[model samples]
Target: MTQIQNPIIPGMAPDPSIIRVGADYYIATSTFHWTPAVQIFHSTDLANWQLVGYALNHGEVDLRGTNTPAGIWAPHLSYDSRTQKYWLAYSHMQNMAGREFNSDSFAVSADSITGPWSKPIYLTSIGFDPALFHDADGKHYAAILEWETRTGYQAPGHIVIAEVDLKNGGIIGDWHRVTTGFTTRGCAEAPQLYKHNGYYYLLIAAGGTGYAHGVEIGRSQTIFGPYEPNPTGEPIITSSPQHLFSLGDPDAGHFEMFNPQSLMQKAGHGSLVHTQTDEWYVAHLMSRPLAGQKKNPLGRETSLQKMHWTADGWLEMADGSNLAKMHVDGLKDVPVHQATTQFDINDDFNNDTYDPRFMTPYRTQDAAWVNTIENPGHLRIHGHNSFFSQVNPAIMATRATSLDYTVQTKLTFHPDHYSETAGVGLYYDSNNWLYARLCQADTEDHTVLRVLQAKLGERIDHLTDEVTVPNDTAEIRLAYHQGTAQVLYRLTDTATWQALGTTLDVAYLSDEGVNGAPGEIGGFTALFNFIGSVDAHQLTSFADFDYYTVKNNLERGTHL
Candidate 1:
């Protein structure tokens, strides 16, 4: 039988919401702090997925000044058979300070999957991870987590359900408070509603979003009524399925529940789908940490697991175990074919358009700063602000998909001032990045290449390896092996590559290492390889890029 690999969509693709429209299957994942929010992937075989397009690419919302792990969260995708429309529901996490967790939910629709989606219809701000469910009787409903802010109540909140009007964005009735959770593992959120065989199944993510994360299920006869927990009294699927002593603890990372035996951790927030061949699968978020370390630089990725319903109507893994596997049997009797499991971005900047995978942070990309038409053969990036600035910065990046990889770029930059710089390197967020760029020296006589590092708002410069370039053009490469990053550069096409800096420890540029205060989760965005320019003085400097390439060396199931 064919085997489907884990992480069908890798690198920071979390909170998967899967739905089947005719023969094609689509999954939408959360894109926090990244502009063109809510990435949607399409797959027909379930083993392979491809990036189709985005739902919010036309600047329906503002993400400027968004904090780490705060922006568009938990995008839910559904198809309305009655209207023949595709619906997307998501939450805009506006604040996380003091655990106030103020968020607003919105919905959009399109006639086709890759489409001219409608403008966002205002939804409720009651909670995050809101999902829209369309019943067979042509009624619409929204299921969400009513965030509990009071000091003494059940910690994170309750899973509430209410009838809604999709056209006008109004709730028809009062929000019904359902169970906080159906299991011992609390912190319930990401509620999805489905009906199977006259039972309304409510799927939830619990046990936080860390080592103890798992997918729990409950059921009720009516759409809004008392629900019953799973008979096993534990998560239907998890990385660590064994009973935990610290149940109901409101901590994000329950490190004590880290399963020493499992390679995949933090497996939860699942979305289910039934294939055209009558096979079932659950796509959820899972993490693969570096060997012997809990730091997840790749962040929460999307993985798939085969599932089957018992005669008694309880969902369970097909392998009969709750532990997520690295490989599993694919859809039965489906024709197996070679699929593109990984992406190696090699852009020549010759096309008139940019790749869909290229993303900018916080704000809509400015045509004045980045343009491909003016230069024709090169990507012209005019610098705006430094990388730390939340506003406008001329950084164009693609997701870092592997722990062991090489990212190289050919750039021609003319820096007349010391504040102007442009090059390619790795980035986690505005607060953490490492870049090797061409800039003017303090003497203001010649141009030089330098390597700079930022960790949690602290900047460090490697002054010893700075090299004087004869001209304005250079090739820069960032080679990463496990947690160490090395910067190399060559002045001319014929010159051999020379080291620009010492081997820098970059493990601290991960989700766990650069986290926020206590009780708050760290940034879950994936590492990115970016080609950016910075002109803090006049913002007139521009960098012309000939090409950018990323090669992944780590094989599946080996390094991961």
Candidate 2:
């Protein structure tokens, strides 16, 4: 079993939808505010997964001013064997100003999971986490909860199912209301359907998506039920294992009873997948609080737990407990694969094109702004004023996926003009970043290395020491040590570094800080290691970056 750290997928990888196509398993996750959203993953053993592509890549949605936690919500991935088509279903959570739960659900189809998918066609303006269940009778059914405030009856939020026309993408029959779910598992939602042992099993995420989250099971002999709750009358799996139902918190399906001893908190909203070896697994979302409290830095993450079927015909955790962890062997001894996250940082810079792993800031990339032919084998980044106020400027950034990692790169320069600064740094939002660059003063054309820091909506203030770049070939290393970070610049040709200072409180500059804004957190956002050249005042001199690399000497506890 591969000893996966609790979250198989981290950093806001919430509402994961997994599907099995023969021996192949794939996962599609939600991305809120980021462009080219809906990341899809593929795996052969179910334990080792790799990102294959994204469902939305053509700027189909607008995400400006999206509040924290409100861009794209739950997304569902499913495949049809008859038509050999892969489908992506998701909700665009447009407005959250009133917490009104306004969402638009849609679907897109592709011959392969990673491909030229058909354009998204609107399905319904309903609640989130919409799933399409293919019935054995050669038909498809759509399941979702209709958030009702004016039903005027006892049940406001109800789970409804209807026959769906997959070809035209529309509801084809009268909607049927299944049970609102057992009283103990209140606020029942994120319904996923499966068929086994002559029963249509409806699995749902119950309780709120908060402290009292759980997975509940209900089965029916028919696609549309008369569904019966698991005989246990308790959640099949949950973090804070509870049977408590108040029926008072209007959001919790109006139930008041709950269990007390749950280990994994907020363990709900999951999808099921059966491995090639006939083992069953559940991929769900969970969060880790800050030390003792519930201030989460990395938002809802994806976790996997083993599950099995009971003799009584209901599905449950393999060990009969609701905790997220399982004792079964997952992929404990899988060999380490080559680095899939990035490229070799050491570069001669004479290459005609940039590496694919490198990306630009908020704007689309322009190829004409850079040229290596001017000076053979040297990167000539013509500074277009400071890092700001330019769309197609020279800035190269890479994703920071691990908690602790070291980044190193070499810089060689012959700047005869003033105000040219080039170096590496960590960036979160547009308003927050820190860098260590070598600059030349306009008056004497004197070159010096300087460190700078920027806070929320503030200028990049020069923080510390200024010294000469010992030699022309300066090697720089930045170590992001957990919550803190440090920068060390050395001249490889001279073999000595004039040390600046380390910023220990990196959390303050993260999405958990004052600037990391909404509909934007971990999913659609990331901290990047960047290599840039800026002309403090005007574009005069050029800063040449020889190569860049983030090290394997991670400072985290696990030494990743």
RMSD of each: 1.4, 5.8
Clashing pairs in 1: none
- The candidate that wins on lDDT is 1
Q: Where is the poorest 10-residue window by lDDT in model 2?
A: 253-262
In the range 1-560, model 2's lDDT, one tens digit per residue, is: 34444565544566789898887888888776544567777776554566677787766665544553466667889887778899888888876554367889888889988878898877777677788887656799888776655535433367778888877877886778896776565677778888888998888877765556677888898888988988888777666654576342334311122223322346778888876667788888765443433334445667778888888887788788766662234643443332333222445566776554455453333444455666666656666545443233356775555556777777776555565677788765455677777766434456777776666657754544666764655777888755567778876557675557645466654444544333223222446677877765556666676666765342333122
The superposed Cα distance between candidate 1 and the true structure at residue 334, in angstroms, equals: 1.8
- Write model 1 residue lDDT over 261-307, tens digit each, in one string: 98888999999888888878899998888778887888899898899
Please give the lDDT score at residue 152 for candidate 1: 78
Model 1 scores what on Cα lDDT?
A: 0.86
TM-scores for candidates 1 onward, in order = 0.98, 0.75
